[model samples]
Target: MYIVGLSCYFHDASACVIRDGDIIAAAQEERFSRIKHDPKFPEKALTYCLQESKITLKEVDQIVFYDRLDQKRYRILDTYTSFAPLGKTMLWNAIRKWCGPSNPENDLYHSINTLSKKDGKIFYPHEIEFVDHHFSHAASAFFPSPYMESAILTIDGVGEYATTSYGQGKDNHVTLERQINFPNSLGLLYSAFTAYLGFRVNSGEYKVMGLAPYGSPTFQDRITEHIISWNPDGTYRLNSEYFNFFATEQITSSKFHKLFGGPPRKRESKITPKECDIAASIQAVTEEAILRLATYVREATNQKNLCLAGGVALNCVANSKLLRKKTFDHIWVQPAAGDAGGALGAALGFYYHYQKNERKISMNPYDSMKGCALGPSFSNEEIEIFLRKQGYPFERLSDRELFSKVSDLLVHEKVIGWFSGRMEFGPRALGHRSIIADPRSKKMQSLLNLKIKYRESFRPFAPSVLAERAGDYFELRTDSPYMLFVAQVASKHRIPVTEEAQKAQGIDAVKLQRSTIPAVTHVDYSARIQTVHKDTNSRYYHLIKTFEEKTDCAVLINTSFNVRGEPIVCTIQDAYRCFMRTEMDVFVLENYLLRKENQPVLFEDET
Candidate 1:
């Protein structure tokens, strides 16, 4: 039997298809539409899923949507009705978005009719099912994890009535034991601070995480007292008077602005030390809550293993903290822990719970994500065809030759856009679609952010270390295949801070060399790490191995290959366009290489 799982009309809309409980294909719509965080019906993603799987809608046995629209609609209506004219705009917006003509109900049927018309037949009307939002998040984390049973926690902005849920999964079943409802969300609480700090909500939370290490946690007390009141039982309540999200579309209220003693920071404004301290304070408090919640989940479930999902699970700092507590013997997180992974979870949930498929666990390194490389991949022929059509200069070399050449360029400090294999499904680039650089270069962190990424300078880069050698550079032993956990730089490799570096504040500290691999190390000496196994990505492993042979360092900077305000490149065309626009020195699509100097001038020389 075949199952098509989908999540849409939410940020990062996506779709996935599974055959006999194995994922066949999965992709986000924004990658195809070129609209960052596209929240429309995932028709394009669904089309890609069908095409990638070499199947059609008629062949699918079930179409399970990630969330129950009607139940969510009821929650929105109930909340707005309680607030009345105070929530008029929010109410109207929710009504139009969910109850409008292009709503999920209509869109689902329209997709079937439009896409399945060729056969004069379609999937049965009963094939579709809409799951609860939090349930989907829980299922996404627990079902695909390599555990016979585990404690599950899912936290994000409100999902219907639930914002945070704690549960347990054993075999094919997941039981949500407790939940915290809307207007009292940890996700929204953090987002409120995100907006107050001049960053976009949802997308900019990671930016806050990156900035936290730059400042001291001076406002942790004020945030705890005024913004969110903590309960002892792994739950909390938001001070709605200080948060406007319940009645207004805005993330923060006037009270929130006054509490912080300023208006929200404007975008493109220079980030001050105050913003850094605020980021640090909130991160500190948030980590505490996450630890308390994880402890509570473990105590309540009596499970030895734990799984995490939802937007909060994407906070790598909190993840690192939770890992330190050792509340559970093993912890596994859904790499795409946000709404994108919801699509994959919804499908898995339907397969196990609804269809009663046998549960399977692939332990040691865990679960069925296949390193989250479950997206489209083009053959050498397809890549070459695109390159020739675009009139871009290129080279075709053998795998060994390509690795040798790219490794040599890295030794000389050239930023190379490495695009190979299938695109990664999760938010992380892994090694398949990444911008690789020599981690030994102290100046590379600033250069890549300002020149190539065109984003905030405070942001830190992650390291993709050779799996066997990860222990040498980072204080870690387990495989971090997904780049989900932040580990401290191994003490042996850390550089002592200078008096000048210690006195530096704000962005100046970025100039300080914190470790041997300073480009990938944060100010606090932490690195979000991805361990590249030779078993999974041999090509990426070989490239890093070649570089290691040349420089005696196995770690390299591996960041998503895109600029600010852009999704990670999904096609060779997207890769080329990004390469031409950025200050990237080299571009590698599959085994082909293209240098910026030899390419046609994309713009008139400003000099």
Candidate 2:
């Protein structure tokens, strides 16, 4: 049976199509639309999945949406109405979103109609079923995970009435034992701090996590005392007194504003020591909460393995702490752990659990995310067609020749936009859609951030190392193919601290060379790692291996293929556009390699 799953009208709207018991294709709308977090109906993503699956909409046997609209409406309306006259604007906005043009149902129907008409075909499924939002997240965690039985945890901003849900999964079935409802969300608490720190709410949480190591957690006591109360069983409650999200649509409360100082930091303003301290405090708090939660799950399930999902699972720093705590014998986090993966989870849940189909364990040790390379891919012919149509100059070479050439460019500290195979479904760019540079270059990180990424200079890049050599460079001993774990650079590669540098504070600490692989190492000598296994992506592995052979360094700086505010490039045109826009030195598309000098000049995007 074929199942089509969708999550839309929220951040990272996405679609996934599964055939029988395997994921055929998946992608997020932001990728195709060139938006950072597209909240549209995901028509383009759905169409792409269907095309990748070689099926039409009519051929899809089951349609499963990621959330129950009615349940969500109930909780949303209830929360807004309780705030009453004070929430007048917020209540009206919520009502308008549900009942007016913002209604997902309307966009979905229109998208389906438009797609069908554009294709000169019309069809509809028998019925569209909506699963609980948190269930979709939980299913995304446990179903494709490399565990027959495990403890499951899902935490996000809000999904209907559930903000955090935890339980256990056994075989093909999973159950939630308990849940912490909205207004008590760990995700929101983090996001509120994110906003207060002058970062975008959902999108800027990672920025907060990244900035934490720069300062001391001095504000931890004040935050814990005034903002939240916590229990040992992974349960947490935001005092609600310090948050006005439900009533004002502004995440922080008046008390929250005063506690953290009068006014929130304005976006794009200078990052202050106070902001860094706040980030550190919240990050420490988050790690404590997740660790407590993980400990609780381990005790409750008595299970050796654990599966984690939801947006909060995106916190690599916290994830690293949890992994180090050894609460479980094994942990498998859904690579696309946020709402994007909910599309895949909803389909998988309906197929194996609801359909009564037999479950099959993956032969691969890491489970069935397919390297998270489940998006659209174009053949060399198509790539050549695009180049030709655009009057672009390119040279085609054999894989061996191209690898050697690109490795040479990387060795010379040239930033290369590497586009190969299928696009990744999640926020990460795993080799297939990555901008790579020599990690050994001391100035490469700053160069790439300013010249190519056009974003914050404080953001550190990740290292894509050969799987066999990962432990040789990073403290991590396990597979982190998804770039989801932040592990310290192995001590052997760390640079000795100087007396002057030892006193370096804030981003100055970031400026110090903490490791031999300076470009990929963070201020604390931590590196978000993606270990490349030959079996999953042989070409990328071979390229890195070739680079290693030449330089005796297995690590290379890997960042997503797009600039600061854009999604990863999904199409050949998208790749070309980004390459032309950035100050990248080279572009690699499959076996073809093209230099920027050889291409036609285009208007540079300095934004």
Candidate 3:
């Protein structure tokens, strides 16, 4: 039986198809729409899933949505009523958008109906299941994980009425035991600080995490004292006086700005020491809270393994801190831990819970995520045809030749756009859709940021290290295939900085080389790692291994293959456009390679 899962009408809208409990395909709407964080119904993504799985919409046995519209509507009405008068305008806007004739439920049904029509035949779904938002998250984390049973934790911005939830998953069953409701969310709290620090809310939270290590936690005390009320049971409530999330579109209130010593920083404004300190303070607080929560989850569930899903689960720094504490013997985080993974969870939840299927775990590859390489892929013939049609210069090479050529380019400090196999399913690029470079270069970090990415100079890149050699370069305890865990550079690979460099604060500190792989190392001597496993992605593993053979270093700088303000490249055309737009030296589409010098000038450049 085929099951179709969908999450839409919120950021990172996505779709997935599963056959007999195995994921066939998954992708985000932003990838095909070419719009960052597209929230509309994922028609294109759903279509791609159907095509990739060689099935039509009629073949799908069940269609499950990530959240129940009734629950979300109730939550919205309740919150707006509670904050009445203060949120009158916002409440009206919400009511008009969600409760009007064209509500989410209606739109969703219409979209499904429209997409199902083919050759004058119409077939509606046999069953439509709407799950609790956080339950979807928990199922996504636990069902795809390698554990037979595990404690589950899901934390994110408001999902219906829930903001945070914890439960246990055993076999094919999951039970959410307790939850922290909306209006007091850690995700929203972090997003408020993200906005205050001059970044987009949901998308820019990681930017805040990247900036934290530049400064001391000078404002940590103030934040803990005035913004959040702590509890002994590992739950906390946000102080409403400093937040405007309940009543207005704005995340922070005037009182919050007053406490922070200023108004929100304008986008693209210069980074000040204050912003850096605020980032550090909030990061510290978040890590502490997460550690406490993990402790509580462990004690309550008494489970040896833990599965995590939610936007906050993407914070590598906090994840690393939790790993160090070892509150659980093992932890498995969904690659697409945010709402995108909700689609996958919705399908799996219904399949296991309603259908009563027995659970099966894949031990050889650690988990059933298949390295999160579940997106669309292209053949060499298709790539060649496009290249020829576009009149772009290119050359085809064998696997050995390609790996050797790419490795040599990296050693020579040439940045290469690597596109191979399926695109990654999550926000992370992994290796399939990555911009790869030599991690050893001291100037590479600044070069890639300013010249290639065209973004903040201090944002650190992650390293794709051979799984076996991961411990040789970084102090990691387990595999981090999705680049979701930050670990320190091994002591042997770390270099001492000058006292003057040590004294420098904020962005200036980025100039210091802290490790042998300086380009991927952050100011705190940490690196977000993606351990390349040969079984899951032999080609990527071989590329890194070949580089290691030549340079005696097993790590390669791996970052999403798009510049600032764009989703990662999806199609070959998207890859080509980004290659021409950026200063990357080489572009690899499958076995074909195109050098920057050989390519024609961009269309804009021609005009």
Candidate 4:
């Protein structure tokens, strides 16, 4: 049976298709729409999934939406009614307008209905089902995890009425034991702090994480004393009065500013030591909360393994802390742990819960995701056809030759746009769609960000190392196939470059250095690593291996294949458009390669 899952309305709108228990294709709508964090109906993504699976609406046995609209409506009503004496009619009306029939959720139903109407002659009605948002998040993490039975935890911004949930999954059955409702959300608490720190709430949380390491935790006691009452049992209640997410137009009210002793900082403004310290303090609190929650889940469920999902699960730093705590013997976090993964989870939940399918655990960590390469892919023939139609110069090489050439280019310090196999399903580029540079080149990080990425200079690039050699370069022992862990660079390899040398040199000088690759290395001398195993992604492994053979370094710089503020490339056109717009030296789409000089100037002006 075919199951189509969808998550929309909220940010990171996406679609996932599954045949039986195996995922066929999954992608975020932002990639195709060229909008960052697009919260639309994901029509392009759904269309791509259907095309990639060679199926139609008639073939799909079930359509599962990630959340129940009625459940969400209930929460809105309940909250508003509770505050009726305080007068919240305006907020209620605004919410009603937002959830009108023309909104994203209604549009999704309309699209499916339209498609089903055309296929009505062949299929039956009432095929669509709505899964609980938190349940979908739980399933997305637990179902694909390499565990027969595991404790499940899902935490995110308010979903329906739940903000956090704890459950246990054994075989095909999942039992939700407890849930923390809205107005008492850890996610919202963090988002409030994120806003107060002068960052975009949902999107800029990572910046806070990155900045945390730079300061001391001076405000930990203050936060625990005034803002939240964290419990030792891993459950906590927000003070609520200082937060305005529920009642006010802003995330933080004037009372919050008074409690915190200042107004929210302005974005792109100078970062003060106080801001850094606050970031550190909040991050520490968040990590402690996750650890406590994991411990409670483990004790309550008596499960040795754990599965994690939700927007908060995307915090790699918190994940590292959880791993270090060893609360659960093994932990598997969904790659797309945010709302996008909700789509995949919805499908899996529908299969196991509604369809009564038995859950199967494939314990091989290498096979947990089929490399998460479940997005669009173009064959060499298709790429060649596109290049010819665009009148671009290109070459088609055999697998061996292609690897050798790309390896040679990397050794020469030429940044290459590598688009091969299917696109990755999550927010990361796991070799399929990536910008590859020589990790040894100290200037590579700056060059790519300034010329190609056009983003902040402080952001660090990641390293894609051969799986077997990952330990040799990074102080990490576990497999990081998804680039989810930040591991320190081995001390023996971190030679300090002088301030003068750092200031005077460019890519050329950095390339000749026998010391630190300062560009990719963070201030902590660590890199977020993606380990590539030949069995998981043979082509990508071979390409890295080829580079290794030439430079004797088993690692290469790998960043998402997109410019700043854009989603990673999903289609051939997306890749080509990105390649043409950037200052990248080469474009390697499948087995075909194109040079910058031979391509048309796709961007009107090179800003």
Candidate 5:
């Protein structure tokens, strides 16, 4: 049976298709729309999934939306009514909600109607059902995890009324034991700090995490003492007076600014020591809270494994700490551990909850993500056709020859866009849709970022290493196929550089000649690594192996295939468009290779 899952009307709208218990395709609307964090219904993504799976809407046995709109609306109304004689800000928010195009019921009905129109010849009414938001997140986390039974946790900004949930999952069944309601959320607390620290809330949490390493946690006491109170039971309440999420138009109020001893930092401004300290303090606090929650869940469920999902679960630093704590023998985090993953969760939940199908526990030691290559892919014939039609000169090589050529290019310090197989489902670019270069190239990181990504300089690139050899490079023992963990680089590989080299070298300088593989290593001598296994992603593994044979190094710099503020490429056309827009030296789509010099001048005017 075919199941269609969807999450929309919130940021990172997405779709997923599941057949039996296996995922067929999953994608976020932002990828197709070229909009970062697009919140519209994922019509394009759904269309791609159906086309990729060769199925029509009518052929889908069930349609599941990631969250129940009625439940969410009820919570909103309840929260707003309780604050009656509502201030102007609250009144405006209510008005917008009641009449907004983003209203939950309106969006649901509109999405259904729009899909029906597109599938007019094939669709029938009453085909879609709504799943609870937190349940969807829980299912997404547990169903694909490598455990037969595990305790489940989902935490996000807000899903319907639940911002956080604790549950237990065994095989096909999942049961929720507790949940934290709206207006009192760890996600909001973090997001409030994100806003205060001059980053966009919801989207800027990662920035905060990245900046935390630069500062001391001097403000931790102030945060825990005046801003929020934590309970011994792993539940906490915020001092609402300092927060503006419920009653005010802003995320941070005047009191919050006053308490922080400054106004909100302006975007694009220089990062100060104060900002770093605040980021470090909040990050430390957030990790502590998550650890306490995980401990509580472990004791409550008596489960040896834990499955994590939701936006907060995407905090790789916290996840790394949790793994180190050993609260659970094993921990699995959904790759798309955000709202996008909710689409997949809803589908899995529908399969088990509504259909009552028995689930099979298959861990797939590499990870159940199937490399998360769940988006569209093109055949060599299609790519050649596009190249021919566009009058672009290209070469078609055998698989062995193609790998050899790309490997040689990497050895020469050339940056190549490696577009092969299916696009990834999450924010991460897992080899299939990646920009690759020799990790040993001193100039590669800066070259790729300044000329290609066009983003902040301090951001670091990741290393994709051979799975069997990962332990030799990183301080990690298990397979990190999803690139979710941040571990220290093995000390043996550290590079020694003079203080003058560091001072003269900007964030980009850290990219050049600090180590044997200077491009991918961070200033801290660590790399966020993705281990590639042949069985899980044969093509990517072969490419990396070929590179290793050519250079005697088993690692390469890998970053998402997109520019700043854009979603990762999804379609072959999107990949081509990005390749043409960037300074990448070559584009490898399947067995076809196209050179930048031979292509039309599509990006001549782009900054």
Candidate 6:
């Protein structure tokens, strides 16, 4: 049986199709829409899934929505009603969103029918299955994991009434034991700080994570004292006085600004020491909360393994702390841990739990994400046709020749846009849609940020290392295929900072080279790592391995294949446009390589 799952009307709108127990296709709408975090109905993504699965909409046995609309409506009403006159504006907006002409709850059937109309054929499922939001998150975590039974934790901003849920999965069944309700969310608290620190909420939390190590956690006590009330059982309540999420669209309120000693930093403004300290303080608090929660889950479920999902699970720094503490014997995190993966989770939950289908674990140790290489792929013939039509210069080489050539370019410090195979399903680029460079260059990080990514200079790049050689370079001893965990650079690779460098504060400290792989290493001597497995992405694996053979270092700096505020490049045209837009030296589309100097100058109005 074929099942289709969808999550939309929220950030990272996505669709996933599963056959029997296998995920056939999954992608976010932003990839096709060219809008970062497109929150509209995922018609294009759903169509792509159907096309990739080689099935028509009529052939899909079931359709599932990630969260129940009624539940969300109730939560919105309850919160807005309590906040009343003060929240009049927010209340009207909520009502308009739900009762408006474009309401998702009212138009899902129409949207689905409209998209499936090919050759004038239109079909809708008998009934749409609505799963609980947190349940979808939990299922997304437990079902795809390589665990027969494992503790489950799902934490995010408000999902219906639940902010956090924890339990366990055994066999095909997942049990959510307890929950923390909305208005007391750790995710919201972090996002509040993200906005206050001159970043976008939901999108900029990771920026705060990246900036944390530049300053001390001097305000951690202040944050704990004024913002949250903690319980010994790892449960906590937000003070709520400092927040305006319920009363207004803004996340933080006047009280929050007063406590912080000022209003939020202006967006795109220069970083200040205050903002860095705020980031460090919140990061420290978030890590402590997550550690406490993981400890509680380990004690309660007594499960040797743990599966984490939801937005908070995206915090690699917090995830690293969880790993170092060894709260569980093993941990698995969904690559699309945010709302995008909720689509997958919803489908898996309905299949294994609701439909009573038997579960089959894959022989692959990487679980069932298929290395997240589940998006659309272009064959060499199609790419060649495009290159020829555009009159772009290119050359095709065998895999061996291309790998050797790319490795040689990296040795000469040439930044390359490497687009290969299928695009990734999650926010992370992985190797399939990555801009790669030599990690050993001290200047590569800033160069990529300013000239290539056209974003903040302090944002650190990730390291894609051979899976077998991961521990040789970093302290990680296990797989991190999703780049979801941060590990300290091994002591052997770390460099001692000079006295002057040590004294540098805040963003200035980013200039210090803390490790041999300076481009990928953060100011804290930690690196977000993606372990490339030969079994998963052999081409990328061989490329890195070949580079390692030449340089005697097994790591390559990998960042998403896009500029600031854009989704990762999804097509050859997107990749080519990005290559030409940036200061990149080379572009690789499968076996074809085109140097910037060989390409004609692209005019802004040409397209």
lDDT of 5 by residue, 96-166 (tens): 88776867667666776676666664333366788889999999998888787899989888888888889
Model 4, span 1-607: residue lDDT tens: 8999999887999998999888989999998898889988888899899898999888888889999877887787777676554437656665776667865556776877666677573332355688899999998988887777889999998999999999998887777889999988888888998999888877888778777765668899988888888677789898867876785558887887987779999987877777878888999989888888888888899988888999999888788778777787777789999999999999988898777797776655554578889988888888888878877789999999999999998888899999999899988899999999987876787798789999755567888999999888888757888877777888778886666655532122323233355556765566788899888888999998998898888898999999987889877787788887889999998899888888766755321
Q: Write the per-residue lDDT of candidate 6 for residues 461-553, one digit (tens) a residue.
A: 999999999999999966999999989899999999998779998899888888889999888889999999999999999999899899899
Q: Residue by residue across 1-607, what tens digits does model 3's lDDT show?
A: 8999999898999999999999999999999999999989999999999999999888888899999888888888888778877888888787788755578887887788888877344544335788999999999999999999999999999899999999999999999999999888999999999999989987999999999999889999999999997898899989999988888888889999999888999999999888999999999999988888899999999999999999999888898899889999998999899999999999999898778898788765679898899999999999998998888999999999999999999999999999999999989999998999999998899999999999999899999999999999999998999998999999999999988779988899999989889999999999999999999988999999999999999999999999999999999988989999999999999999999999998895331
The global Cα lDDT (0 to 1) of model 5 is 0.84
Clashes of each: 0, 0, 0, 0, 1, 0
Q: Name the TM-score of candidate 1.
A: 0.97
Which ten-residue region of model 1 has the weakest summed lDDT?
598-607
Q: Write the per-residue lDDT of candidate 2 for residues 404-516, one digit (tens) a residue.
A: 99989998889999999999988899999999999999999899999999988888899999999998999995789998999999999998889987898777677788788
TM-score of each: 0.97, 0.97, 0.98, 0.92, 0.94, 0.98
- Find the 10 residues in a row with the least total lDDT in model 4: 504-513
Residue 524 CA displacement from its true place in model 5, Å? 3.0
lDDT of each: 0.88, 0.88, 0.92, 0.83, 0.84, 0.92
lDDT (tens digit, per residue) of candidate 1 on 1-607: 7788888886999999988878888999989898999988788888889998888887888888888887887887787877677878777676786765677777777776677787566655565788988888999998878887889999998787899999989899888888999978899888888988988887999999999999889889999888778788878877778977777777688888888888999998999989999999999988999998998888888989889999999998898888888888888899999999999889999899877889877643557888888888889999888888867889999999999999999999999999999899979999888999999998899999999999988889999999999999999856789999999999999999978669999777888998999999999999999999887788899999999998999999999998999999998878888888999999998889999999987643311
For candidate 1, the per-residue lDDT at 225 reads 86
Model 1 C-alpha lDDT versus the unseen true structure: 0.88
TM-score of 3: 0.98
Model 3, global lDDT = 0.92
Clashing residue pairs in candidate 3 are: none
List ranges where model 5 is wrong by over 4 Å: 82-90, 93-102, 117-127, 496-514, 603-607
Native RMSD of candidate 3 (Å)? 1.5
